[model samples]
Target: MENLKKTLIKAARKAHQVFDELKDRPSSDPIKIESYTGYASQDRMFLKGRVLEDDNIMVTKSYEELKRIFYSFKRFETDEIPGVKVLLYLDDHEFQVYTDEEGFYTLDIATPDSINVKPGEWIRGYAELPDIVGDDGPVRGTIKLRVPDSEASYGVISDIDDTILQTHVTSLFQLKMMFVTLFKEASQRLAMEGMVELYQEMSTTPVGGKNPFFYVSNSPWNIYPMLVEFLKLNELPSGPVLLRDFGFGMLHQNEGYRGHKIETISHIFRAYPDMQFILFGDSGSKDADVYLNLALEFPDQIKTIYIRHLKDTKNARRVANLINQKGEVDAIIIDSTREIAADAREKGYVSEKFVLTEVEADE
Candidate 1:
């Protein structure tokens, strides 16, 4: 009898240990959808977004609430909820994919010939999370394809930092300044003077048509929504904003941080093989170096290179020498977007009417 009692006591202790360990385990989070802009082509469509199980997500409707808006960045930069089922609805058809380890899902789907889309036309796409998600329906997003407009003379591709927005990325107090600017309301953030005018001129076309503007930034995808709001507030030309995934760790840089920009640009080049591109970036970072290499690599596709001088005269000189050696491409360094507007007019990259109207509006 004593032996049986001892066995019962042992079992009770084991049960208690198991219960204690189970109580400490973290609960699994339900899937939440975070969608981004997608691009489509003549016969193919590419869509991308991240699936997260974040419970603390709070979106600020107004830019006035700086503290609430700042916390939204934290909610997105956290770990991706992997292995979740995601359904993408393109028009009437549907495509299914599972989130990868990083909680990112990309769909490269071939479109039926019946679904005819034109250049600059925005296609509606819905990212449907599993029923386990709390949302009522699939998250909606827009798809922009590389439909070459015969009216579009060339396409404009630009960097977001000091080139268009004052990021101070190369400043000695970069991190501190970034923290201050990032937390501020988007309306409070300052846009580079005369940049919108220049970009608008570049996006101009003959016969009341306009060229496409593509923004390729090194900023992480976590802050993408905020960036969109800022662009709208500033009245900048809208286009595909391609960004990188910084992943779970705040300090961890993605392995492709150095080459991701070029890789993305290469994809754009391939998508629209016949379209010529004008590149823009700030000289403060590796923009000059990367763009120089890109000009050489895609000599026929690159039309002109514009580098915003961020006190990096030395790098600018190197870029000019290299481009001059090539003899096929034009590269210039400027202090403001107004300089680009002047250059664009002289080079016939944009119509004189567009430049004049932009200047008048600013005045």
Candidate 2:
């Protein structure tokens, strides 16, 4: 019995050592990379990258196992790459490998022990920059690739102005000033407290196998870099960002506002009909209304909708009423980002999870 125990321990140690070695191996060939400056809202930005692939990839393990493998890369970060992060569940995870002197990080994933991820479950890879305290900080970037054994294919569709950056669209003048400045000064501002947590939640959520995050914003294209810088400063999650170009004609229709957020959501739903979505936005605009409408229209596709309350407004009541009327939707509205996170742990959305922090005065 003692001999058998010793053998088991030795095997485990050997397996761990092998994993460590595998984590450190470099890619065999240089791959083509594309970089984009992604804006989360008016206040946040993320530097995102993707390694294009023409062939199908396979991943081994259950969806849970695949998620775990992706996350296992977390043990390998050095001080030189502060922005290096990992997202995983079961056997699948993504790593933000170290960057070069040019401030670029490449992603390389080894074929898994088994191939379980179906063609529909494959997803692109992405990373967010590390939060920097000062305005003049370095930019952090990430790269992604397909792995063997993955069974899910996914993509992200997110809100832009408030969800990614700090732009408050409700006040059109402030929003315009934010645009006029090109978000230069504002992008350097500190991240809102709990924003990191909120972003982390968004990035790591399990969506159709392993899709890349897709960000949709109302801000015009010129300030895309500013938004990316803002996300780096906040150390938020990274994904493919879609920004509104002023020339897109919709801006002309919205009275100078550049994005058709509702339409964009509809487009995403149409694009990936089988994919699940984890929606993030604020109460300053029509996010709540849009998400509510989405829940009504496509009940199965949306997994969760997280709305951050910027002010004490009737929007929360209206959201609640809408949910009550439909009797569907796993949604919540909260004064702070942390509360929204806490509620996420519960299986279902409870009123207590989204209760307002402020109290109303008695008439």
Candidate 3:
């Protein structure tokens, strides 16, 4: 009887040890969703975001440029949580989407008659993540989208670097671009002179509602927040800011990179077939090339082209020669916003009373 009692006691001790071990094991880290600024048309609303482990996530917090850059670095290096289920909500509509291998979730919903999205403003929706830390059920991440206003005369499609912000990407080996990107925060970065007012003028229509702006750049999606911050801090008009999603070695750079700008712009054109656009870019990179190609394909939809002149380079020279050659499709190699305002007045894009803020030309 004593031996049996001893065995029972030993089993009880083993059970207690197992319970202690189980109690001490760490719980899984909560998840997070990074939803990007999305856009919609009459029929289709597209949104793209990512699922990631909430631990070790860094956003732009530090005011110090050096610390800020490191924070940006760490933010980009965070791992994506793939194969997660995300529930997307747009008003009374709900959709289920699965993250791809890159932990990116894309919501391409076709709501022809369901969603009554109007233009000239942004609409807000939320994503339901797995759960939050509290008893509040699933965590919610905010998502925003813009649709074109019916009163919009023409939408503005622009490049971010050099065209809007002063990112001198044409410098030898891109030394200046690298320095500005790595050492400077978005607040420290400068936009092109007179561009803010010029773009603001362009963003308004003759009537009440505001015209939309679509910003595209060769910069990767890792700096998406930084660019968005730059736009917001500078008070630049906001729309959908699209950037390269590849080239980090996190995924193959060239996999979907071939004709990326062309493909992206093409998609935009397809989305708003009835609406026309004015294209803006710098001579640097393939902006000129891509814009010209788009003009060729969508002649009726392209209203005009404005390219900011860069330092004398082969591409710049080539664009200069090709500007006047595009027959009836007015492409201007602009030196200042005065020129833009003057021509915009002629094109009826702006009011005749809209005056230029800058008196001097940009050199």
Candidate maximizing lDDT = 3
TM agreement with the true structure for every prediction: 0.79, 0.48, 0.84
Rank by lDDT, descending? 3, 1, 2
**Please, what are the lDDT tens digits per residue for candidate 2 over residues 62-104?**
2354453332222112112213332222224433444432223
- Give a tens-digit lDDT track for model 1, residues 1-363: 989966876776666456545544465755567777766667666667887655554333544466655575665446566667777776676778988756788886675676666776776766776545354455433443444465788888889877887777766658845764557545556666778777766676766677887889888877776677778878787777888865432223464655768888887877677888999987767777777777878888888888876665566566556545755567777766767888888888877654433342233
Model 2 earns a TM-score of 0.48
Task: Note each model's CA RMSD in angstroms.
Answer: 10.4, 21.3, 12.8
Give lDDT for model 3. 0.77
List the global CA lDDT of all models.
0.70, 0.48, 0.77
Off by over 4 Å in 1: 1-31, 54-79, 109-112, 131-150, 248-258, 313-326, 353-363
